[model samples]
Target: MNILVTGGAGYVGSKLVPKLLEKGFHVRVLDWFLFDDNIFKDLKTDKLELIKGDLRNSSIIKKCMQGIDIVIHLGCLSNDPSCDLDEELTKSINLDAGINIIKEAKKNKVTRFINASSASVYGIKDENNVTESSKLEPITLYAKYKADLEEFLHSQASEDFSPVSLRPATVCGYAPRLRLDLTVNILTYHAVTNNKIVVYGGEQKRPNIHIDDLVNIYLLLIDAPKEKIHNQVFNAGFQNYKVIEIANLIKSVLGPDKIKIQITEDNDHRSYHISSEKIKNTFNFSSQFDIKDAVLDLAKAFENDLVKNPNDSKYRNVKHILENEDFINNKILG
Candidate 1:
């Protein structure tokens, strides 16, 4: 199978593209190549195609969709902060540009359109087990865009065109292109580097999944029966924990004595939990790695100097977003 993974050099994509290659699929990575420019630089493979282009360009979208069997649409202003940087830019890339990719993919007869949606679309849920059938109350512009695109993708689904949406939780773990901005990662990074973990409100509960498990689900979707996945939306979050629990988990993994926890008084209301039972029942998939694994994986990666300096600007999404405002608004948007 031939696959086109948009934003294929990113944190999840960096881990996924290589696996796709191992499975004997001809992989094409269409990316802006800004954040992870060094990720796939040394790869010398005949089966991989790397195209550095903006997704907003219709020509680029059409070009990438050419012989693609599956389109893993991971490209976008990924997080709430990144999208909130500029509403127009976020909508342009996340919503408008994404539509272009789907149009071209459907036009070119791509079998599967696996959208990388966010579980954040559920917002601050009071219910314990928020399933895929729950109403979407997107709290941020980033999530609103995801909900909007999911609407368009489902409407576009047809007999030959299978558009599946995976509303994934906050992913955590160590990847080739590691991110320190996530809850688990940043906490672990602080524990490893600063010997401290700070929590504003320790009671907030957030759903999470290991990067490995997330990648495996992508592979499963690639090979799933069309009937099972056509226009299906699956919630992909397994682990649920409070902010303090995550901080303490990091403390346990990376020297509890050395890592100190400082909890400040604040009402941090950003808590969300989701049920993955539907996906589990559907794909016969279960998570092997948990919060401990994510912490240990990141700890090991830092110990081996794999992520030599987690403090680097490239490792933080918000850092890059703030620094490149002009470039993103002009060049990337254009």
Candidate 2:
């Protein structure tokens, strides 16, 4: 089967495309390749095809939609900060482009549409366990678009089109296109490199999942029966903890003496504890790794000199976008 993965050079996609290739499926990755154009350079596979282009380009998206049995939609200006760059641009890049992709997938008769939605959609939930049934009160433009995309995808679902949206928690752990901006990765990188973690508004409870488990979830969706995932949304998160708790956990795992937690006050109060019961009960899918494992994996990667400078702009989505204004205007936005 031919699988078209949007944002295939991203943190999750870099890992997922390889696994798809291993499974004997032809993988076509459509991405802008902003982080690293050569992320898949080492992959010498006949089943893998890489198309470096903007998602906004209808012609490029049209090319990607062809011969695609499954559409793994992971491309977007991720996180709240990244989308906060320009309100109009962010909407165009993420929401508008996303809708176009959904329409194209429908027209192309794609069998499965596996979307990577954000748990942030359930913004600042007072409820203990924010399930899939919970109302989405998106606090950011980035999150609002995710909720909108899920709605659009479900609306497009038909007999042949089985669209499943997984509102994943803040993803943690290492990937070829490693990200240091996330909660787990941020704390772990600072602790390992600077021997200190500076947490802003450290009390917000956040849900997270390991990158490996998230990739596995995508793989499972491909083989899962249409009846099981059809027009369904699942919360793909396991570990739920306060920001300081995660910092302390990392400190404990990485040796308490090696790390010190310095908490600072900030108004970034977006927090929620998501329940993965829907995925577990419905599809028998559960995350095998937690934040502790994510911390250890990132630490090991750092120790092995895999990440020279974790603070590099390339490791961050918003930072990279901010630093490359020229590229954003000429290449990415165009």
Candidate 3:
């Protein structure tokens, strides 16, 4: 099968693209290469095609849709803070650009159109586990757009066009293109480098999944029967942990004596415990990696110097965009 993974050089995509190649799928990547493109250097096999361009470009989107059987749309502004930076830009890329991709994919006869949505679309929920059918309460601009896209895709789903929306948890663990901005990852980084973990709103519950498991879910979707996945929205997540609980796990992994935990007030109060039972029951899909495994995976990455500078803004999505405002502004506005 030939697959097009938009934002294929990103945190999850960097790891997923290679796996897709190993499975003997022809993979084409559409990315701006805002971060390093070198993540694909080692895996640049004959089956992999990397295209550097913005998703807002129609010509590029059309080029990417050519000869594509499946379109795994992972391209977007990503996190809440990053989308908050520019609402207009976020709407263009996340919502408008996504609509274009879906339209082209359906027009070109693509079999599967898997969208990367976020569990943050649930916003602040009660202690009960939220399912895919739960009411969506997107608080942030980022999640609001994700929810909007999901609704639009659902409306467009048909017998020919299989659109699957995955509301993934906060992805944690090390990827080829590492991101230290996530809760588990950021805490692990600070614990290793600064000997302290700054945690905000210890009581806020955040759903998390290992990066590998998150990628695996996408792979599963590729092989899943059309009847099972078509027009279905699944909340993909493994475990739910409070902010302080994640810090404790990191301390446990890196040694409690070596790491100190500090609590701070956080402005962002969005929290929800997502349920993955529907997907698991339907497809028999369950995550293999746990939270501790993710912590240890990150620890090993730091030990090997794969993450030399965890403090670098490039490793953090919001920080990187904020630092390169002028460059990003030109790409979006112009």
Candidate 4:
């Protein structure tokens, strides 16, 4: 089987492309390679094909679709702050481009199309557990784009073509293209290096999934029956905890001497805990890693200086990305 993976140079996509190759699928990766193609440099195999291009170009997308039976769409301007750059650009890339990919995949007679959706669609609710059936309240343009894409995908699912949307929780842990901007990774990095974790909205509940487990969830969906995943949306996460609780968990795992915690009352627009029961029931999938493991592992990576530099642009925060789209787009040196 041949598969096309969009955003194949991304944190999740970098890891996922290798996994697909291991399963004996012919993998064609369409990525902008903003950081560097070095992320997949070690992945040498006859079955693997690398196409460096942006998803916004229909011609490039069409070229990547040739002989591809499955399209795992993971490309987008991720997160709320980044999408706020220009609503027109966000909708064009995240929503409109995504819809076009589905339409193109159908036109090419692709067997399956798997879309990566965000858990942020739940918005800032005071709920203990939000499910796939939960009413979506998307405040950010990013979330609205994803929600709109979900609606469009549902309309495209039919007997002939299948589309599955996987709503993964906030991902932690490291990858080839590392990301330190995420809550768990950020807190752990500061805890060990600076000896303090200053956090806001300590009581806000959030759902999380380790990077390893998140990749496994995607692999599971790729192989599951069309009847099982077609036209379905599943929330992907292992556990939920308050923002402060996550800090404490990291401190506990890495030892108190390694970290200190400081909490603030500032409440960000993002706050919600999600339930993964629907996915567990449907795919027999459960998260095998937790915050403690992620925290400890990231701390070790920091001590060893595993990922070149912690402040590297590729691993930088969303705020940094939004302000310097040129830095990201041009891959400038720091």
Top TM-score prediction, candidate number:
1
> Candidate 3 lDDT, tens digit per residue, 161-247?
999999999999988898988889888888888899988878888889998898889999999989999899898888888888999
Q: Each candidate: how many clashes?
A: 0, 0, 0, 0
* Higher-ranked by lDDT: 3 or 4: 3
Predicted structure 1, TM vs. truth: 0.97
lDDT of 3 at 69: 97
Candidate 1 vs candidate 2, TM-score winner: 1
lDDT by residue for model 4 (196-228), tens: 998897877778999889889888988898899
Residues 97-146 of candidate 2: C-alpha lDDT, one tens digit per residue:
89999999989989999998999888888899998899999989999999
lDDT of 3 at 144: 96
* Residue lDDT tens for model 1, 51-159: 9898888987888888889999998888887888778888988999998899899999999999999999898989999999999999899999999999999999998
Measured against the true structure, the TM-scores of the candidates, in listed sequence, are 0.97, 0.96, 0.96, 0.94
Off by more than 4 A, model 4: 317-334
Error of 1 at 62 (Å): 1.2
Candidate with more favorable, higher lDDT: 1 or 3: 1
CA RMSD per model (angstroms): 1.2, 1.4, 1.6, 2.8
Off by over 4 Å in 1: 332-334
Q: Give per-residue lDDT, candidate 1, residue 252.
A: 85
Question: Model 4, 215: alpha-carbon shift in Å?
Answer: 0.8
Model 3 accuracy (lDDT, Cα): 0.88
Q: What is the lDDT of residue 133 in candidate 4?
A: 88
Error in Å for residue 89 of model 2? 1.3
Best-matching candidate per lDDT: 1
Model 2 bad stretches (over 4 Å): 268-270, 330-334
**Model 2, residue 269: C-alpha shift (Å):** 4.5
